[model samples]
Target: MAMRVVDAAAAAIAALLGFVLALPFCLAAPSITTHGSDGGGGSYVSAVGDPGMRRDGLHVAWEAWNFCNEVGREAPGMGSPRGADCFDLENGVDENGQPTYKVVHRVTDADNNLRAGDPLPGSPANITDVDLYAAAKELYLGDRCQVPDSPSPWQFWMVMLKNGNLDTTAAICPENGRPARPFSQTSRFPCPGGAGCMNQPLVFHNRTALDATGRRLRGGLFGTYDLDAADLGSKEVSYYSVTWEKDLGSGGWVFHHKLRTAPKYPWLMLYLRSDATKGFSGGYHYDTRGMTKMVPESPNFKVRVTLEVKQGGGPNSQFYLMDMGSCWKNDGRPCDGDTATDVTRYSEMIINPETPSWCTRRRIEECPPWHTFRNGTRVHRTDAARFPYAAYHVYCSPGNARAAEQPTTYCDAYSNPQPQEILQLVPHPVWGEFGYPTAKGQGWIGDPRTWELDVGALSQALYFYQDPGTPPAKRKWSSLDVGTEIYVSKYAEAEWTLSGFDIVVPEDCVGSSQGGPLVPEFLILCDETLILEIPNQRVPISRGEEEQGKVTHTHEGCLEEVAAGEHLVGGRELAEIPDPAPDLGDAVAAGAQHDEHGGGDRLDHDGAAPALGAVDGEQREASERRAEEQHEHQRRLRGQQREEQLDHGCGGESVDPSNRWWARRRRRKWGRRDVGSGGISRRAIWGDGIRSSRSESSRRIHNGRLLEAVLGASSF
Candidate 1:
């Protein structure tokens, strides 16, 4: 009887949620169109905002690592797989006739050639051993990409390379910062041969210079891992190259990347990253330098850029359309330089249309317990038919999730600096609500596009599990980037071009709105205009059937679905309608006590609970209940405001409707739709409800199950 009642209350709440979202379905799903935004947010994002043109004057460097994200051994003469070519072009006419200007390359050959033991020109006292060599190399590149004039100085983008080979017999890499014990191969780690297998790449760079096009300039950095192989003239053996080019008189610079794998060096990875300006980046355990002078926090920012992948590198290549990086303590506190406790969290949209999803019924560990919809609804992975399987490549838990759900799969530990968590989304309808590509190859080779993604909104809807009682950690992202990590596979190659990278935050939700650990170097202006006070107010308008106190429309010749009826949210669902404490646990309360039941005993009604059955004539019933609740919520809100006004009546000030409207308009401007059954709007949750049942059914989406049923769509 108790189980039945819980199911019924859930059904009631669900039915209420359905009535609110019906209109959005009739209007059609919201299109991915650009909304105007004033730059009023706490974000040190990318410099270029234009999506079509590739911007130049960029500070891009390179770093190569062994299997453990470390430099195992400098390949022959290659000091380290870390180097960069950064320059600024000056446009002007020569003395006689032809248009000419001196394009200067800041980094010298000596800087790039310095080997492991060689002392730097002016090495700092603190950097003694290998740290000094790494620091000097970084400073060398920093000098090249350094952009002047601003109070806060900046550096170049980092091009990271890694070889997935661990010399286990050698036991070179330490275990958690301590020395490692020698071990034999167990068919797991890919340490092919003996000593030389983990060698770094031999690097070469061709500095940028104005080409014969007179209007065009080009430069490149190339390298190979087969130290003794004579393949520099040709790429017969393992090879990689990044050639950046741009028309001096035209658009932004375009970076063209080409990578090939050889037998000796089968697994390889290359990525273009926008790291922090000066702080530890995603996987780095050091004080790093990068592009995000200001880090963007959860549910507040968006990333804009263009990617054109020419060739999908075989099967193992994990091509990320957009990869977000963040670091936080397991206890939900900010990262205070603790390697053991600081965890790196990553969310990646893998765009390999051919990539198979590893998150299947048998591979429950690779899947989060539940998948969140764009709306605040959740769908358990056990609901196989409802979970969007094809929409995800795989999901690996943070190595540290102590109480992770049963039968879980932890992330590959040998890569990141510390324990890591990866949520790899795929190119499926599930992501269409965030302006992401709905179909495979939508933004690949033949197609290039300007994407405006609501990264903040979508991120808020993702599943990041923590211990039941732990406070929700602020999803503060440290790195935002795009590139491909081509796993070790011989006789294979990958290529692509990237440009117009940007990170954007809503104009209104800046300053205190997006909270995170305080870093003095990031915020300078400390603008208060970005701070937003979201007053919880529900708008009451009749939208689904009139006498039923609801409003909606129907399309002709559509597939039949559960009929709409009135059945509104009651019981604990109405408790604290908006922005409850983040500490709230997602686990369902086991049962209800006496007086907590909403009126009477209820039934599961069908295979699924009826209250959760938001569709059918039940909604007509819910509409009646919701109408009364909306009025009550509004009345109570107004009364509270009135009391506050009376307390300050001596000041002769009053809150007007215009002011309320203005605040509401600002919320919409910032794309904060607030979708929830209790306080947010139906339109907000059913952002994808407009699609005809057929289209919606074809792709998976995150809008809660109610949206799926209301739109007559299916999942999994």
Candidate 2:
């Protein structure tokens, strides 16, 4: 009798609210075309699955690491250090014509709570070892959260937490990728409590759900490295939290991050990363999965993000505005899961004003061998007056570089699975051309701003070592992130919010199995003024003016004409592209130009110049297309081979390709959509809700607000 009444009451409430449950689906399931070339002739495509992070349904995950970028041991009851939160939003109309929504989650608490000894669903067998289990679990979670898309399926954004305590006496980490024996405790590596100091954190998740307002989604992961602490709010306890929230109908998701350090865990690092969907990423030797649908290569990609630093972590905080990581051999080959041969390379821009530059003339070993200016000029560290010493914080060479210059500081040997190289930068006039901060405190704290960093150009200009006779390695970055590393600072706190994050690369550069251009034609609404804000410029389009025949826009002193019905957005015009730098041979000669300044002998191991140079236009284009085709073919073959080898159930049982799981993966691997002659309509470009009849005043107001939200008030 009581059950009947309760069921009747629930039905009544459901009917009153007009609540309708929709079938579970991923965000933007019916793929709309997203790749295009602007009218100004710059062709580009999003490198990430969720461009600008504007999708209402979100996909994100979390992972924790010890000092050496691995799961040392799991905390008390906290499973294998990997977890995910992925969900889709369902919309419905209420009885009063008001809107209603529901969050349909893809992953559950049971999946997240699986411990090291537990079996992974699609693994070859149950893994009992903690480190190997964590790596396998990450792959399992990635499968659960994977989103089907063109080119390939992608996983989630990674929120990575790392405890920097190192127990040298335990000898768990390798030295320069070689096995290390136990040693006495040293003050150099922080291990406040000795033996178990490198344990993983206690992670707690708040599954995403409709907030009290019913119009917003909210969720978070919060916990402490100091697992014994009873209260997270206490100053002595290390705590970290990353919470996400977004309104239902519009705007991008904002990730709120807070990290605090305690005495015992003084060196802690937290970052939000866009890692490669497959293969090794950054310092990890295991196969990793993440949001970067296409790994971005140096000299061809740009990173756009909106960051607001609310509280500076402190003087000891190494706040990286942008951090890029990749792995390659010193001999110019790609890494193939060999820890002994692979080397991780990292470049970061530290925005903390209090951080001092350590690459001064007095500390010559801390500086890179050479610095390249935006105008293609080169200067060696020995050319003290010409070299911008203040631009660099510190540069450490890889431990295994056979021909590394004398008086160089090798990077910390035990902090990564393999040898590593690091280039740390500080704000100075030298970096202004890359859209980086021109001075200290530009984007720190109260000066929060949206940064459109030309990471490709900057990285191309930066110096990275290669073997003397080898071809330069392709700088394909597998991980790009932003965060703070509170280095040996106790009771310190850092707070920030990140949004509108995106990685963009040239459309033609991205591989297409079909061997055809991936450009999409875009249509503009009849008389609407479309305003597009790209990296360094704003294009205001008034269709009425365009119909007068040709639309002309000036970019970098060059005039580009756009025909009617065509539009431009999201990329730089061709004329804005600077000439490619000289070949590595020429760069070596240029470096030698300053030989009289006592840097002559350092050029011996600089290697062949980077693969950057200009050639006759038509020939260069054709050659590049052919090279890309060959590379894509090889890449596909490798991918298929890997897939076949790893396709098995938990008990090492092979699963048929006809199974639903395999079918989904196969269906998602189709190439990009062929370009259509008719072009994409305005509705396709901006989605359906925008009204064509909105008043000019109203549209102007809306555009202003959007610019302010994305670029901050300074954009005006």
Candidate 3:
């Protein structure tokens, strides 16, 4: 009887949610047209600086990594395995009255060839460790590619390369961010010939220059994982390359990528990422730089891309047509570099036809508990007849999650420096509502199409875990990418081209209005004038006009009832704002409660209930301990500096090794699990009927930012 009641309530909420979202779907239907404006004025603006990669000037970079995301040792002569091709184009008329472009490359071979132990320009000559040198090199390249803009400066498109060979005997990778002890290798995790298996790749770069026509710009980066191989063109070695080109004044740049794997290095990954320009990007512990200037939050952004997959990497290839990544703690606070408590949340759509779904009716743990359809109707994984098992590839719970569903497989603990959660989906009819491929091979090899996906609507509907009674985490995605993970397979190769990549968000939803109500009114703000016109009032408000009035109106298309206190901005109706709160809380509550139940019922590797409680309490203690350590280190450093100055008279202050040790220690502490923030609760704007005083919003954000700054400074 209780189960029946829960089902009935869920059905009712789904219906209500469907009614609220129907009209919005109609208003912003997906279109292939590049321009959103009709020559008249419009509100839409591209969130990316180089939207569609159409700009004449190109900014692109590449970074290579060993098994643990660190550069354990530099390639023989290839520097730190970080290189870039950023250039500007100067246009002029030729003698034949045709257009001509002269390319100006910013990064030179000298900059790219600075090996690990080499001195960097404009910096003290003491920083020489391979991993630290690579981090510094990326920053150097970013400076050469930065484009200063309104909100924030932006960097180049990042081409990331990674190898999945782990030398377990090395004990290099931390165990879920803790100090790891060496162990014997397991078959599931590969380590072919153990020693030197985790070496960095050899790199090659083709600087961007004028094409034969002198009207096009082109460049590329290619290399191999087989460090000892003499010939890159030989067929027996693992290899990868990305060649990008753009017409002088035409459409987006096309990035063609090809990756091949050999028997020794069978598992590899390559991705073109639009990472955040500042702050920590997905899966990265340090501060970073990249293309996305304004991060896109969930349920309010759209992603567009043009992909053509010529070859799939055999059956093991997981080709992500679209992959989104974000970071947040289990208890709904943003990540502040605490690896133990911070979880990397990722969602990917594997378009490879060979990838089969591991999520089935009988394997509920491999699936998110429920699937929410377009019309708000949700079916649990146990509903064999109604659940679309074919739509999911697999769902892996976080390794540190104590409350994960039974039989759930934890993600690979060694891949990332921190615990991670992943949800991989495949093509199916159920995804059609979000403009995704509805069937297998819909956008594969021969069926390439320019996709304008309604990512926000779809992501909002998906199920991600959180503890019960905790405020929901704001899904502010920091990395939007497209690429492939060719799982262990010998002699397998994949080729693809990606273009017209972009992420778009509603103007009002970003920045200041992050926590504001979702107003349905057509808010036209021109020349300092803010016009809020209801749907009934189609009359256009002229620019530079100020007016304040109230009017009653009704839209028969919208059927959801507005709860009390949810008043329109101005009058009878502000333009029936899509139900400010779509009643989808029943689903969230049910999902979250299930997580708590799992925590109590499940056992950790050490046979105990994991430390899932006292989130804020423990985090506060961690923060204070971090602060005390910082003061102690600073005081000791000051005394040492004074002693050096007095003893040596005029010696330059040297960089401290203690500082680096402090960073590693902090990373280890973060690996120890500090879940939530210090009692910071701002009414999370979810469909649930939860509310909080507006007074706490500013204080909470301020403290979050302050703590983030403190943690960052303390580490560096």
Q: For model 2, where is the 10-residue window of minimal lDDT?
A: 647-656
Residues 1-716, model 1: lDDT tens digits: 32222233333223333332222110000111111222232333333222233545445678887776666556676664567777666767777877776677777777777766776666644333553467556766675667642213567777877787777788766543345677886445666656778878877888887787676778888878777777554545778888888877678878898888776777787787877666567777666666654455545467878778888788878888888887766555556666566777789888877778888877777887667665434566777889887777788777676666667788765566567778888888988988787888888767877787777556656766554433245555667788877766766788988877777653322222123211111100000010001111111111111122221110010111221222211111122111101111211122311110101122221121112112236754675566565665544544444222111100011111111121232233223443111112323333422122333422221212121222222211
User: Can you tell me which runs of candidate 2 are displaced by over 4 Å?
Assistant: 1-43, 96-98, 511-716
For candidate 3, the TM-score is: 0.68
Clash number for every model?
41, 1, 3
lDDT of 3 at 419: 80
Candidate that would win on lDDT: 2
Those runs of model 3 whose alpha carbons end farther than 4 Å from true positions after fitting are: 1-43, 92-99, 122-125, 510-716
For 483-542, candidate 2 gives per-residue lDDT tens digits of 999999888999999999999876534434343322211111111223221221223322
Reference-based lDDT, residue 602, model 3: 20
Task: Tell me the deviation in Å of residue 586 in model 3.
Answer: 23
- Higher lDDT: candidate 1 or 3? 3
| Model 1 TM-score relative to the real fold | 0.65
TM per model? 0.65, 0.69, 0.68
When summed lDDT is taken over every stretch of 10 residues in candidate 3, the lowest stretch is 649-658
Off by more than 4 A, model 1: 1-56, 97-99, 126-128, 148-151, 174-180, 232-236, 509-716
